[model samples]
Target chain A: MDLIRKTNTSYLIFLAFLMPIMIGADYFLIQYLFNSEVEETLLHEEERIQYHLAKDGDLPISNYLHEVTPIDKGFELNPKFKDTLFFEAYTDKNIPYRLYSFSSSIDQKPVKITLRHMLPEIEELIWFFFIATFAILLLLVIGLYLIHQEIYRSTWHPFFKNLSMLKQYDFSKMESTQLNSSGIREFEEINQVIITLMEQVRKDFQNLKEFNENISHEIQTPLAIIRNKVVHLLESKNLNKNELRQVESIYQETNKLSKIGKALTLISRIENQEFKRLDRVDVSTLVENILNNMEEIINFKNLDISTELQPMTIECDHILADILFTNLINNAIQHNKEGGWIKIRLSTDTFEITNCGDVSEVKPDKLFDRFQKGSSSKDSLGLGLAINQKICEIYEFTLNYESKEEIHTFSLRFKA
Target chain B: MKVLVIEDNLELLQDIKSFLEEEGNICEIAPTYKSAMGKIGFFPYDILVVDITLPDGNGLDIIREVKKENIDIGIIIISAKNSVGDKIHGLEIGADDYLTKPFYLAELNARIKALYRRKAYQGSREIYFNEIKIKPDSYEIFINDKPMNLTKKEFDIIHFFVVNKHRLLTKEAIAEHLWGDHIEMADSYKFIYTHLANLRKKIGELGGKNYIQSIYSVGYKFTDQEWT
Candidate 1:
């Protein structure tokens, strides 16, 4: 599946087919050359026999010739060439030979002379060449494969290293990755492009963060001035009843505006990932402390509060953790019915808070959305649960809300 | 008491100066950090109310400079940026208290008074309003030299009234002073009235004079003199 193995397999298949064909070609070529050499020796033997016959005026006996048959009629005009088997007296076995027969005149009568050459020596020479060629081809293939593996590993090392660096890069930290220069031109180009892109993204992110902070600060200053001016105006001793009522409404609206402004800033800050300080916060103790802080509100509503806590710790921003639990507990207290019971359970990996309240009129899907208020409380800014959800998202925790049978439950699960 | 208010906003600064002046304190204003530095270098005041962000410079630097010149001057940082980082940083640089913006003027007054008292007395300070006396450190109150039983919230309300005696206190300011930021989520300020009524009843049961007077539909005013 990887590049090196895929190429090696294809090369091996090609070699598997080519090896046998190369050996067969060598075999045929060697055989043809050996046959020509045998033919030359046969011609020499025939000439020597002819010379002896002419000198002695009779055929001479020799080990090369086993038999000489005399024909009753004249021989044919052309020579006949064929392969035949002859028996050897010493070994008592049939040996293969290349036999050539021709017609010649002996004592003015036509007779045929044949010469034979045994082929066992040429067969052994062909076998030796075939095996040697195969061994050489095998060695060449193995050497090429090893060289290719080494080249592949060294060439692709920088690419894989860059890939891991990209994986570990975090935008929140705003730290640039230091890329090593690969001598390869293409890899260097790719690394340069990525570095430029990341720098641009970080610049854009910083600009957006500054914009949010500026807007929040700019808006809050004027709002503060307006609220303070109204308070100062209300201190006048000559204002009538209607004037007092109007000023009171103005003061209350300013307060509400201030609250909404702060909440919006907090939500944006969470979304921007500004809270980077993380610690191992004890979630159980945090919940207990929040519940105790909300004791007055709970008592005012005459709600019976109970908690089951198992010590649990999670890594999160400490201030955000405080806000998370405060919002959850406040939501529970604000919505609970008079004389209702509130139950909280904390475990190693999960924390759940449930309270008895009137059937919620807010849609289940929109419960954690900003400005989504319940029908009962109009004064609520409705950003509490939304902020809590944002914090959970930042920390990679799961926040869920469910309402059934007049009981509303909020649960958070920490990633293990 | 002589106080210096360093704020960039002209209108808010004027209001704070006039309000504190009406409360029988000498008040001065510096609308920028450079002017504030000039004023603190030349003038010695009981307290310095500083805004963390100023038009010319940072209020934190002003705090550091003032602390170096005079360690006895109390510093309260006011900022529209309600971040915990700024608050902690300001306190670390010798600020005695931190108040986020859009805060009530009454709340500001109470913090200024408390800071001044802490600086002047060091410890073992008691506030007296006619026959009502409060020991803030011990969380004990005595009416006509007899111990009075009160809850934490009740005691805080009484202490706040005694510090800002004869000054009109709004329900919103009282709620903020008692509950801090949590007061924003309340559907009504009616709980504050309940706490005040209970405090009044307890004081009357202890044979103490009634000093808390309602200012019609506005709020309440705690003064020894009766006003119609």
Candidate 2:
């Protein structure tokens, strides 16, 4: 940011310096050209005055040249002193003539007028130079302004305009938002730095995923072995009723452990990006299907599920969407009081699943954080909403939690 | 009744086979999908126990094939994938029961018998557990085969307790099993007490042994030991 600011400031300053210098040079030349033209006008007057006085009266020509008063300081030469002003003039060399300049102020003063003829043409040259210089300076300033705009459009605009995309980049898809090679060495350097940081982050994430997958697989096999062996021992016919009950406790604990492990593994996979995008899913149908299977439990718990389903379709990762929906629904069903009421609503692109419960023990903002339970419900691992939030992040879906009147509502809105 | 158990694991298969045989039911074994498909094709067994993750293909596919052949077979899918979708899929594909793997043989056997009862009589039979007998079709209960008047909920509570006997049942599980998932809204187990009270009064009036034991802060248990 500082570098861009520096470049922009330097460009502006260079243009600023160029503009007034050119303008001042043209202004000086214009003043010089105007004064010279006035001097030529007075010289013509001097000649006419000298001729008229010399021919018509007894006054000497030198006296007449000196007698004309200066009109103003516009001309470099004073009208009275035009003949006495130093100048160079030339005629064809074939016609040689004696040249003299008469001094009008001093009696009998000889004044040379040889170079006075060239003064008018030199004045014209000065005028043309001033006009051309002024025109060029005006054009140059305009050109600089346009060049500044073009540079801003090509460089600064793109750099600053697309910066929000960088801000909103989902860290899960780090590789997808990689910067294209800008060809500019400075930008390329910055891009390389960003890519290096992202690559390191990606590598760390990969290592974490590998670690989690290994842990899950390692723990799973042993848990599975233990569960099967327990079942096998229970059926061996050597155990009495008391022993069987003891074995039952082991099975229950194993079941809970398996559940926690499965949730953890799923979370890691979500973190690891092992999900695929499938067909567009009708969320209403998915919710209905889950609810149908949950019917037995719902009825047994005496919960009332009121639904307002709309025909809505969303292109989503089926596995992630399933996990998201199931976890939310199961959480609602698991944490509520018996005979609780669950209300579900679906619009064209929004879904709201609300369940009545006591959540005074929880802050709503922290509800989506892992293992933050609002209640001491044994079945809840509190990873449900966190996993759901993660899935939402992966798919760019939005999940919002709102509580009102003791009703907890999870709202999911799909991007169009 | 003969049950054809199709599982890839030899020890678990043997355990299930022995456990069922001990329960006085004939047990047949098939270790691979091909063998299970072959046995299912030729054998007229009462129940077909299938493990979903087979060496050849999914056990759910076999269930579909059997259904397509118009064979009235009772299939119980046993899988290590305890995902809700897997269970729902297995059952939706015409499997009579879905049991997650590493389940006790007793649980498997119980599911098989439940499937048997469901398929054989379409849930119309008088099931007996010692002196307590239940006629599900008529929603009737009897002690020593003598009729006992019980309320609707009392009968349901007893039926659930009897079917899931010798299991550590949580209050939530019991409530969900009885009322539905909606039981999450129930303030307490006060209604459970009401149902148990009604059931006990009816059974006591019938001069039957009282087996209901309140497991303080947990749930009630019905055992044949104390009852006898």
Best by TM-score: 1
Candidate 1: residue pairs that collide: none
lDDT of 1 by residue, B11-86 (tens): 8898889889988899999999889988888878999999988888999999988878655898999988887788
Segments of candidate 2 deviating more than 4 angstroms: A1-18, A25-253, A265-362, A390-397, A403-416, B4-23, B27-45, B54-73, B82-96, B102-107, B118-126, B130-160, B164-222
Candidate 1's residue-wise lDDT over A300-352, tens digit each?
Answer: 67889889999979999898998888888878887878789999999899999
Best by lDDT: 1
Quote the lDDT for A53 in model 1.
Answer: 74
| Model 1 chain A: ten consecutive residues of lowest lDDT | A66-75
TM-score of 1: 0.69
lDDT of 2 by residue, A322-357 (tens): 667877787788767778999899999788888987
lDDT of 1 at A66: 39
Candidate 2 chain A TM is: 0.61
DockQ of 2: 0.13
